[model samples]
Target chain A: MQMLRKLSAGLLLLAVASFASTPAAEAAGQTLEIVKKRGHLKCGVSQGLPGFSTPDNRGNWTGIDVDFCKAVAAAIFNDADKVKFTPLSAKERFTAIQSGEVDIIARNTTWSMHRDTALGVDFPVVNYYDGQGFMVRADLGVRSARDLDGATLCTNQGTTTELNAADYFRSNGMQYEIVAFEKADESVAAYNSGRCDAYTTDHSALYAQKLKLSDPKAHIVLPEVISKEPLGPLVRQGDAAWNDLVRWTHYATVAAEEFGVTSKNISEMKSSSNPSIRRLMGQDGSFGDNLGLSKQWAVHIIRAVGNYGEIFERNVGVKTPLGIKRGVNALWTKGGLQYAPPIR
Target chain B: MQVLVLAAVLGAMAWLVGNVQSNLERQNINSGFGFLSERAGFGINQTLIAYTEDDSFGRVLAVGLLNTLLVSALGIFFATLLGFSLGVARLSRNWLISKIAMVYIEIFRNVPLLLQIMFWYFGVLRNLPSPRQAVSIGDAIFMSNRGFVVLWLEASAGAFWYGLAALGLVIGGIWLRRRAANAQITTGQATRVWRPLLGLAVALFGGAALMAGVPFALDVPHLKGFNFRGGLTVIPEFVALLLALSLYTAAFIAEIVRAGINSVSKGQREASAALGLPESVALRLVVIPQALRVIIPPLTSQYLNLTKNSSLAVAIAYPDIVSVLAGTTLSQVGQALEIIFITMMIYLSLSLLTSWAMNRYNQRMAFVGNNT
Candidate 1:
């Protein structure tokens, strides 16, 4: 008994000591300096959501969210390939960021008040303007979400889409059942196997997941967009410098699209007389210095990922399998919500 | 020395908690159980009690707890029944029966429980036909990918009086049983107890039904817009989780039981036979009762394992405590510390309760010594 007591006490002290050291390590907020020294940006993304972050056959990732991480990498290291992707589930994404497992979460997470305030993470920019929508079988004849009364819907758990569906059903005085799964693939499989009447998620995700269905052409996305889902990248709160770096990297892409700067023509447009272009290209001011980056940061971003429009059109545009239109994701000048502060 | 050790442990715990609180405050994340009252604006697939999107997070946890208990209870009941049968069958003299039991025990015990759950869920249950072309039985029960729906009874106002009448008949039957036992002991008369009790129960129930008009209406299930509208809808998740948990735990339980029976001395069986007791009676009244002393201890562990293993219900989305409270609610609330601590405490309490109940039974079956 004496030996057992001594051993247990020793074990307790060791556990307490180890746990005491972790909070101090996690409390260090110099994420940018750590990323710089580590030589790579650790990015958390969805396990497999097409047009957001899905791995290709060659193990290379291709999506709008993937490009955003690459854009941040390009701004910091001038090399977009200096990023390691950690695929995470919906329930694991925020914890991954808070636990310092990843520098940023570009997993197409919605920017909600509760998440922004309580999750200890900050949504720096809205990379994609999405909304919760439903997709049902074409033979079901459900043309709109309003017609989905008494329907059983399948969705990914721990997502804003689940809460949005609940609110929509309740406010509309409709009776419905929701079957939520941990992984996106499981929810989609459940929906495809006819366990649910419809599958609901962000509109872009619905279009992306539809292609994975056994008979894609048999499904129809409803016209109703129920809740606004401003999807974006997340960084740990209290790291203002890292937050600014990520926020500006996304704005640089939007500004590049507004200035008609393509990766192919970036070299020729460097000497252009446009002041905004000059400043964005790092030829005019100390804009990058304030963000703790090099002067050619935006140039590296443009050259690496070729602006917001290029990334979108390449990954999920009209020519791609997702074929999502640049509706609200288009620039403000083009009657959309994509706006950026002046580089000066 | 023990008090000094306890003080050191408590000091370490206090310091650790203080460190966590400081870290949470620094990160600006609120930490408390106060969020339990917040509106859970989410939907659960299966709930034993009434739940809605407007309910509080506390209500969601309650619903999840009830679901976990429901599956664990049903799993324990079925596993015990199947395990005892398999245990006896494994000791059977017949070659085919014993081999079949051996093969079953070997196969189920070797595989991981999570994979078995997924196999039953995705491979078997999800492959059922859709609601549009549901396989129906008698136009009242429906089997679809949505679930297995069976006609259920809805009680009316007359159910109360009929229930009281049945309760009175049960009490009267118990009284008659005591009187019959007294007569057997004192007068050596073998009075028939069961036949009269059964006859009285039937007559009383029949009269109650005649006056109360059966007190129940059958609620039939029919295809609605998306799925079945009525009846007792047993979701596929529950069935798959229950089936996998029961079968997997029953395999280990069968082994424990068989070993227990084998441990009984051969003299005990032979001695009963020498007294001219029939083989079945000797096994039940003598051998089996002694075997239980060996069985109860390890069998308690199997029960606890099944209860804890029910957490794998998260894999198949059964809306058990782990799936709804720990998986979904923890993600939404982001209170990993508080939620995980509570979940651990729940599982610990459940295991301890199971151990306590089994210990009580073991005490009752323990051999009592009499010294003269």
Candidate 2:
């Protein structure tokens, strides 16, 4: 009995001591420095979302969100090759970031008020401003989300779109039942199987799903924008410098677009007398130093992937086969919300 | 020396983790269980226990744990009953009877559980017609893509009074059995087991209704515009999870049951027959008692595995522990360490408790067999 008591006491003491030291350990910041020494930025992304993040036949990742991941790598190491992308599911996305398994999440996740205030993570700057919409067979004659009042909605699990749906239904005084699937693939399959009345998700994703249908022209996304879904990259709570470096990597692309810079002409513009261009490229100033990076960090980003317009136009926008227009994602100067802070 | 070596290794691991934590903290990234107390701002796909998006991580974990228990218990109860019955049928001497049982086991046992769960959840259950085209069993009961909602009787206060009176009669019957059993030993008067069995059944239900002054009331389900009103509703996710688990585990149980029966000696059956026992009574009162000793241990483990595999509820977003705490709440609060550790501990406790209870029951069964 005494021996058992002693053993249990030892275990209890170990548990309590470990529990007691957590905050003290968290107060010190050595892991971020450890990551810097490791050289590669670990970014978690989706496995397959077509234009956002998907693996090619060669196993190399290529998409708009993927390019942003490499851009952060360039901002940090002046080499876009230093990023390692981790493919995560909707269910695994949060835990991967929360457990420090991945340093940052570039999955097309929405920034909700509850997630921001409660999730111990921060989503800064909307990379893609999407809205919740419904996609249905064109023959169904569904022209609006409001028409989905009594329609069965097929949606993926563990998403803000689920709650946004409930709010939309309640406020509109519409009655509809949800048919939720854990994976997006299952929802798509069920929708195709004629199990649901319509599929609901972000407008961009609805377009993607529509294109994957047996006959792409047979389906159309309804015109109603029900909720504001600002999809962006997220970093863990704390670590201001790393967050700024990541957040600015996204901003640098927009800033580059605004300066009329393209990857094709950036090399020649290095000697241009444009003051904002000089500051952005870090050719004339200490903007890079403030972010704890190299003077040519922006230049390296442009060389490896080009500006935001090149990245989007090559993958998801009108230039590519997805054929999505640059509606709300255009540069602020072009009358949209893609605004970047002035480096001055 | 080995103990000291292991302790040294454990200490080194702790030191390494501590070093990494301090380094991460200096870079201003928070760590540890502080995140668990934060609010869970996301909604789950299906929740059995009540919850809101605003509920704390602790409450969410509780909901997940409840869902895990609900499904696993139901799976174990049904699988064991079906498995043991089929297992006996497999060992039957009749050619046609045994052949059918062999085919049933082979077909179900060979398929992977995950494929079955996916097949039921996505392919089969989702194919059901919409609520608007609900399939009613009779005019009084309704079933459809919405779900089956049937009429149920609710016991009221006056129903309890009559129930207790019936229970008292059952107790009187059981008392008569004890007296008769003692008389059978002393004066050679046999007592019927059915008398006490029937009495116990009457006591349980009658006592509930009669002593509590509860009356019986019927609750009839009604269908409204798009859904059923005033009846218990089971979701497709739950139906799929239950069907897949029960079918997967039952095939294994049947084999264990067959093995237990085969392990029994022919001498036992012959001895019972020589004592003038009928075939049905020889198999039940003689053969099964001995076979139970062989059947129980592996049967218990199968039940435990079924329980643990229910954690795959995460795959279907069944609001089980893995999906709610490890999947949703962990992301909501970033409390990865605390939530996962607590979940593992709970599962470990559940399995251990089950094993302990099974061990106790097996001991009692074994002791009785040995004496016989």
Candidate 3:
């Protein structure tokens, strides 16, 4: 009994000591220093959401989100492969970042006011302009969202998509049932097996997942975009420098596309007469230095992952299996939402 | 010294909580239960109570808890019944029956419970035909990918009074059984209690039910446009989870039962047989009571395991407490600290209550004095 009492006392002291040491640990901007010290960026992505971040049989990560992570690595180390991917579920993604398990979360998470203010995470830029939409069988004769009365919809649980779906049906006075699954694949499988009349998620994900159905030609995606979903890369709060670096890594891709700079012609564009392109390519000014990166960081990003347009078209655009049209995702000059601040 | 140790532990706990609070403040993560009263704004497919998208998070949590308990209770009931049968079958003299029971226990216990649940859900239940091609039973029950629809009784207004009459009959039957047992013990006269008690109960409940124009009516399922129109529709999630949980837990329970029966000595059974008691009566009156002494303790653990393992309902999206409340609600509210702590406390209390009740039964069955 005496030994047991002493053991418990020792445990109590250890607990208190551990608690006393945490405040000093979280101070002094730890994320960037740790990343540089480790020499690799731990980027969190989706478990297997096609066109976002799915791995091939060779264990190589692909898709647009994977490209964004590689671009960040290139800007920091001039080597896109100096990054490791951590596949996470939507329920576990925020906690993963908050706990410092991953440096940045590039998962296709929607930016919302509640998440920004309360979840202790900050979204620096929207990488994908997405919105909630529904996909149903063509034979259902459901032409629009209003035609989905008395329909059973399958979706991934613990997401903004579930709430938006419920609110839409409730406000429209339509009776519907939602069969939510823990993972995106489970929801897709259920939808494919005819357990639900429609499958609802982000418009881009619906397009990507529809290609996996046994009879892909039988389903048609509805045209209505129910909720604004500005998907972006997120980082833990209070790391200003790291957040800025990740933010600019994405913007550099968008800005590259706007300047009509292809990855093949990036080296040749260095001699361009356009002053903005010269400054963006780091031939003039301290644009990269201001963000605590090398002068040619944008050049490294472009060479590593190409521009935003290239990444999208190769992974999910008209020629890919997903074949998603760039509607609102087009450049701002072309009447869309992909805008980047001037490099100057 | 013990008091000092407890005080040190308490001090550590308080300091840790203070550390978390400061960290949360710095990170700007909200730390309160005020989100409980906010609108849930999400739909649940299956709910025991009245719920809508506009319901509060508190109501959603309550609904999730009810669903968790409902599945766990059903799993425990069916697993125990199947386990006791398999346990006896394993000990049967017939070699084929014993081998069949052994094979069942081996197959279920070797595989992980989560895999079993997913196999039943995705591989088996999800492959069923859609509602358009639903398989029906006697034109009253239907099975499809949507759900299993069964004909059920819809009670009328007079059913309430009829239920009261049935309760009274049950109480009278219990009294008659005690009187008959006492009469047989003291006077050596076997009273026909079952016939009289059953007759009285039937007359009371059945007569009142008939006079009230049959207080219950059958609600049959019919084919609708895309699904069944009426009756109680059991969701595929519940069926798959329940089937997996009961089968997996019953395997462990069968082993426990076998060990319990073996713990009872052969001499006790032989003695009962020498006393001219029939084989069935001797096994029930002598062997079972002794076997129960060993069974009740471990049996409590299996029950608790079933309850906690029900948390795996999330994998198949059964909307249990962990899936709906701690999972979806926690992500929506971003109050993981409070939500996880509350879920842990709820499960702890449930296990404690179950063990407490089982311990009482164990004490009743314990030997009166130290004889061995």
Scoring each candidate complex against the real one, what DockQ results?
0.66, 0.24, 0.64
**Model 3, which residues run further than 4 Å from truth?**
A1-12, A19-24, B206-212, B368-372
Candidate achieving higher TM-score, 2 or 3: 3
Q: Which ten residues in a row have the lowest lDDT in candidate 1 chain A?
A: A19-28
What are the models' TM-scores?
0.95, 0.82, 0.96
Clashing pairs in 1: none
Which stretches of model 1 miss by more than 4 angstroms?
Answer: A1-15, B165-192, B203-213, B368-372
TM-score of chain B of 1: 0.93
Q: What's the lDDT of the predicted structure labeled candidate 2?
A: 0.76
Best by TM-score: 3
> Between prediction 1 and prediction 2, which has the larger lDDT?
1
Q: Which ten residues in a row have the lowest lDDT in candidate 2 chain A?
A: A23-32
Q: Give TM-scores of the second chain, every candidate.
A: 0.93, 0.83, 0.95
Model 3 lDDT per residue over B67-131, tens place:
99999999999999999999988999999999999999999999999999999988898888888
The alpha-carbon lDDT assigned to residue A75 of candidate 2 equals: 78
Model 2 root mean square deviation, Cα atoms: 5.4
> Model 2: per-residue lDDT, tens digit, A1-344?
65665566567557756755654443333334645788888899986777888788888898888998888887777788888999987767876765577778988999887666555567876889889988887877677777766666778776777767767886797767666566787778767765567888888888776766767787787888889999999877666776787788888888888888888998888988999999988889888888777888888888788999888888798766588898899988888889999878
**Cα lDDT tens digits for candidate 1, B249-286:** 99998998899889888888888899999999987888
